[model samples]
Target: MFHSIYIAGAEAHSGKSIIVLGMMEMLKAMTPKVGFFRPVVKQEDGSDPLIHLISNRYQLPFQADELYGCTLETTRKMIGEGKIDEWVKLILAKYRHIQEQCDIVVCAGTDFAGANTGLEVDLNARLANHFGCLYMPVIKGHDRSASDIADSVRMLEDHLATHQHCEILAAFINRVPNNQTDNLKALLEGSPFPFYILPERQALGRTTIGEIARELDLKTIYGTRQSLTHEVASYKVAAMQVQDFLEHLENCSLVITPGDRSDIILGCIAAESSDTYPRIAGIILSGDQEPAPQIQKLLKGVKPMRLPILHSPHDTFTTALKVNNVEGRILPSDERKIAVALGMMESYVDMQQLRGLIASDHAKRVTPLMFEYELIQRAKKQIKHIVLPEGEDERILRAAEILSLRQVVKLSILGEEEKVRSKASHLGLKLRDIQIINPRTSELRKEFAEVYTELRSHKCMTLKAACDIMTDVSYFGTMMVHLGYADGMVSGAINTTQHTIRPAFEIIKTKPNCNLVSSVFFMCLEDKVLVYGDCAVNPNPNAEQLADIAVTSSDTARMFGVEPRTALLSYSSGSSGKGTDVEKVREATKLSQSRRPELKIDGPIQYDAAVDPEVGRSKMPNSAVAGQATVLVFPDLNTGNNTYKAVQRSANAVAVGPVLQGLNKPVNDLSRGCTVADIVNTVVITAIQAQEVKA
Candidate 1:
């Protein structure tokens, strides 16, 4: 069964809350634990009314902080920074934490109450797709024609299909008039998606006297609090005589009259007590004029079965006008309305179909977008401090701003304090909370230099030479990671790859079982993330070193949530050509499979045969790893580097790392032309790596 499902709105006020409330009740009936999440709430401070209602009513164990993902302002900032993927990561992190405690989760989309609603629609679709949840859109049909309702549903279906690539489990047209239900059903009969039509109920949409009094700033003069939720069927002005006014009274009618009209008030109260007359909803006394003491005494005497009497300063006409416009909301105190809504949903919606949809299996396909999202989420689970050596670079500063905003990792930047701050200010980037350190003047410089000397003393390095080396930001940043001041280091945005990784080699060195460090780029193509190895480190390796790279690269792929199916890329398909390169690749393939017997690996294969299913079937029909490889180990760095760049440019892919593996600690390098996103991704990867090392 699916672990979660998403409820989205086709438009504002689509009665999505009814579906959510009903689904929660339904799921809770089957499972003892169910979670509710609102990924984007319009309210500041992250409070949502629906969350409070569901959590409290169901006695969900989730705290208030756990129920909301973020506020509108925070969501807008993330979207503006092209960090929606990162935002999704944050949401998923929170959700996974919540899911651990529950059997299923119901994630609701945005309320569409603020600006940029169009953007919010796209965001909801992305969130649903990322969560791999069943998406059900609720369409409001009140005050809309049958044709208009059909058009809206069709348009929403097309948007989700074309833009989001999400399959709708089902949809609902809520609040349609009873007369239009059959027409709307017939119009949607041929839809590829399943849909249901719910007839309008005035009770479901009616505002109570207490609600009106609160909205119009009226004071309740006499009534039991329980009577506040009574539905108002209609409103009438009592300016005429009491006898004539009684003729116009309807069931649940709210009477508006001058406060001094004791006869009209007492007559309505008496009629409510008499079975011959229709029950009145309540009485609204207008113009702030109270009845005489005798009337007050009579009202006090009737306090045992008090009617809801409200007093407003506005005249009867103005009070009636305001009451006509009052719209009701489902408050926590209103259990009767909540029960009505739940009953309506359970009666109209197909619970069996919904349960089947929720139980259906979703194919596990990790798109590149999902892989990137998972990366940030994994990094945030155990946040580690990462130091950026090239802090003065604008890309680095911008990345720092995002990292700080998301709280993905603790950041320390190594540069001259004034220069870094000035450059950040010039670029309109905020780095106020990020740690800025001038390597030469930092308080930890002496300590870091001493540690560096101790680690490199075997090479006959003097203390003075070590101090001089520590003055360089790259060396200082790497030393911070080595000395446990920071968890990892990411640099090379303005420096060469060597300048970044060399300090790590001199101090942190390689892991005990590893001989050399290699690198891989998580080439995020359209559908999947392919790990390209030795792409930034190691120009060439012999058969044994190549096998080691394959093993390490496979571990790296799995570390970032990609299942590793190792493919050794060569110039020729299996046994099709003979050359020194082909021979090396074949030997490396044998060596890798032997070393890591658990890993599925195939080699001496052309790129086309390795990645394309049809080509692999024709070339290497019996290979387990052919055409389904997630980790591609190249024969040399030249092939891997050029191929990744070519594919990145051609396919518009996101190449996340040249993340160094086989290291004792995590230190990563970035390309000189990398964007802020690229830098942020590398830093996050480094943090995850550091977390693994600590583990």
Candidate 2:
């Protein structure tokens, strides 16, 4: 078991940063203070983006000079001068400086990108032994066979661990094909330490707009600091006329045209505005020229454009080549890609269990960060089709880009295709392969209207009226959920909650087993995540209805890894007070346990007694759910809603839902004031729920 780890690659381009970044993410969740260091970086002056990415993303308080001992160039020169001992001392001092301030520090070995492989390997082995840290060797599995990998691992163990006295933590084999994992595992069956196999992730190699700008030193003209995170899928030189250029547009394409070509510039904007063409990642104005004054004025006169407009001094050809060759990695500015990289670590490694082996003192609880990271990975494994009704809004479009980029779920946006496309273009959004539909003019409208009429015919509904109502985006999106068109629907960004869920109630309805629908907010606090129940749906549930809420909320808690030690919350602690509310909670607790015999519940519990260990023990010593309550069930909406909001604001917690439960199919409503991040999370949860429905 080791708190700190040193990662060394078997060869150049082993892509060991994936393991480094992944380890840092896991350490951040498991421990309070985590630090990162690089023994020998490529750049001696500490201008490495990986260093900055870790410092900024994790909010480390280390300066650039404090991050690394020396550059690879410096190491080579020092070794030639017979100063290897001095170099070791320098690196050990720097590593200790960081280790002193952190609970654990993750250090990266020399970038084998272009270093002297044998010398760097020796240095890493020596440093690991000196630091008394765990040595983690990463191998590239792209073209290597089972026997090849096994031989390499055996050699490393024999050299580093056997001769150099370095503690071998684990071996990582990255970029392997799915079919090769088993053969590789079989070949290395007798390894001393566990060997982890990670498949190749294509997105890990793709560069973003910010990386291109930094690599080429392009001057930004239009995009904000945030839009710079857009990933460039492809690039093209727009040397043709406006009509021809419009005809040749591509999805997420970076357009490189002459700066003075006002016709092409306006044509690109027009393409974005019409939704008839592909989405543009950004535009590059080349040849050392600027847009004409009139064209610039026209650009300002138009509605705010998000398609990043940049200027490059080089000619179109040079700029295009530079853009294409820009290397991609997880940048501090791009949290979405960081999520993707972290997802790799989460899916392949049993990080929680691994922590027990490495850090025995680590608290056996799920942090909010770990929960959110695991949530995204879960949704990606069972990709479900989800529909968004408020497709024209900027927040919705922005979230759509992230969802599409991550490939977490299949998405359909309900709106006129042209309008949604125009919105997407204006936002510089790269919504690849997302289905767009116009509810009013869709081929399924008649079918949806007929289904609606038959379902509501008992209420004296007419076909014409049903057709008119079907034109509403909310109703259309919900109908998609009812039919096999979409697995789930998320809305209420611009609409009221009633407008968003009325159609679900009228059409999809509740499940056959569950008579009531309830809601729970996964309140992500500072350290742990807790589930708050009946916060958005039920107003004043009776004992039976409240009992149902407790049962469903417990399942929801367990679904998200919050083990349910349910507390039926009221104003009093178990049998200590007399009130109708307390009585109702006590009755509900009994009713819940009777319905689900395996439930752990105690009712008439005060909030403090239910959460504080000392208070819970003092007040309800014999009760099972006195403390350690992961799920809190509120007796009424007024209490549940107010308490959740108070904790969210006062304690700085992230309230993830009001996630709807008890539906035959999954249909979730969003708060009207939700942000782009909220929309993204809600959609992810809805997709997971849709998978549950199928199950």
Candidate 3:
């Protein structure tokens, strides 16, 4: 229910700013009134282009000094005075002010050590309590080891856990090598927190073939695939006084030889005779010697393989070392990995790619709401009053302006009014349909005092303090929906699921008879939208919990136009194994059937049998859910996360979510690593949920 969100990082230069800006850009497309903020600023040169660009492009408003939680002087004195809470209070006041102005607020954070060191726990607690902001830790995209990233995430999570009392939305691993993607995904699969695998920016891949050749000091004799990158492995030399040639040609991709050495002719013949390895680039003959007839014949035969032989004329030692150094040298005509990553990202992380990457089998189904949309089209009811939370940047603000102008949704951004307008202006964005609201101003009304008091009665603080806390967008969001102001609320851009939902629970409450809130992700592909549930919320749900999860997921599937044939998955199948794991799935299946007798549910089934028709037939004859289980329910979080990732990376399936379920109203959170398409899908899902709630 949070109307304003704050995007924070573990440290500065951790790409926190970029992530916040990107998310803002995506959110703005759907709703207007999106605002940006930097509640606390420490280092103020006032001329940093990045800050300037953010200020102008996002139309954000912040005195550089107010952006940081504590001043250097405040920090310097806190060490001597031990009064961190005082500084935190100052920070909370500013955040509350920002929250009161806009429908959505994007609050950027200071560094890890400096801000936290001043009042450490007290400051964070105040920030989290006051704003109910979801703290997402962003890691730098360096060549750090996997363990290093994990340790860093662990440290951030531990720190935030102590102060925020919320979930780590997701850990973003940025700028990773393409080859190392699978390894990193696997490594983080078992992590306690969500891990988003982001590729290194492609802007770094601008190297051309000529550049690479020059760097390697090699002549590009023949090849227009001049763009073909040479990731050279260890170069090997087969110096046979002619006899040792056989062993030398053993493991080399490129061969280096003395041009005058006619003794190796026999070795060349032997190498040509073996079909073991394919010939790649041709040989480099040093010392510039013309080959003898026998050598010439051998070279001609090898030339048919299309290997380009080059005459380096350099000494044997120099040539050997020279070829060995070409592994990652960027060619002049060729693009570097960085550039390729960028090019790929331009297309790869786009809506289509994101949809494709996370697409599942159920994505093909259409929701029942298509009729509702048609009805709305017929009725011509204007769609308005769209609300978004805080922590938005320039890009998002521009999108919000567009959506507003296009009349897509009534845009509402949560943050400070002046700051929101200022950021929009800086971005050259015109938020025509957007309206700004500070949650603090509206949430402190006398009507909400009773509910606010009841919700925060047990926690630390008095009625006034609790009232201030309720003014936070998190609590205000619930009030907005309760009071029937905005048609729907979209949050979790910068907040955790809990932070996003806490206010909803305290005020809006759940639909009658609904218990055990769950989650589902709509994994969209090119033309499909698969439903994955309970992958996000439940950790180790037992039979009852599993049954509840299955039923809810099935309903979600049906809502999306998918026929809900539920598959309760496990490691073993058809009673092949005996353990609590298998028993739990079985019991859940029975419970699901009893609870919803009409649901086509199957359990204790292998993934293959659940998804593959052939496997389903072979394993269980005449099974109803065999090979057509559109909704898959895993035994535990570990299994669900690992399997989803493996399928996404290895089988090339697109996985959209951990879309949250079981809320009184529509509210979902985003992974720090989510693409724009993911945001779009989550938004659509939220829209649908909102429709249902309204009905």
Query: Top model by lDDT, which number?
Result: 2
Error of 2 at 21 (Å): 3.2
Runs in model 3 deviating more than 4 A are: 1-385, 394-399, 443-446, 454-462, 651-653
lDDT of each residue in 386-419, candidate 2, tens digit only: 9999887888988887887667889999888877
How high is the lDDT of residue 689 in model 1? 94
What TM-score, to 2 decimals, does candidate 3 have?
Answer: 0.45
Task: Say which candidate scores most in TM-score.
Answer: 2
Steric overlap count per candidate? 0, 0, 84
Write candidate 1's Cα lDDT for 371-458 as tens digits: 6555665786788999998877877887787677556789999888888886664343557568998999888878887887788788
Q: How do the candidates rank by TM-score, highest first? A: 2, 1, 3
In candidate 3, what are the lDDT values of residues 328-437, reduced to their tens digit? Answer: 32222332232233223222234232223222321222322222222222212345355676526443464455344323456677777878876554333456657787
Clashing pairs in 1: none
What is the overall TM-score of model 2 with all chains considered together? 0.81
lDDT of 2 at 247: 74
On lDDT, the stronger of 2 and 3 is 2
In candidate 1, how many Å is residue 632 off?
Answer: 1.0
* Per-residue error (Å), model 2, residue 178: 11
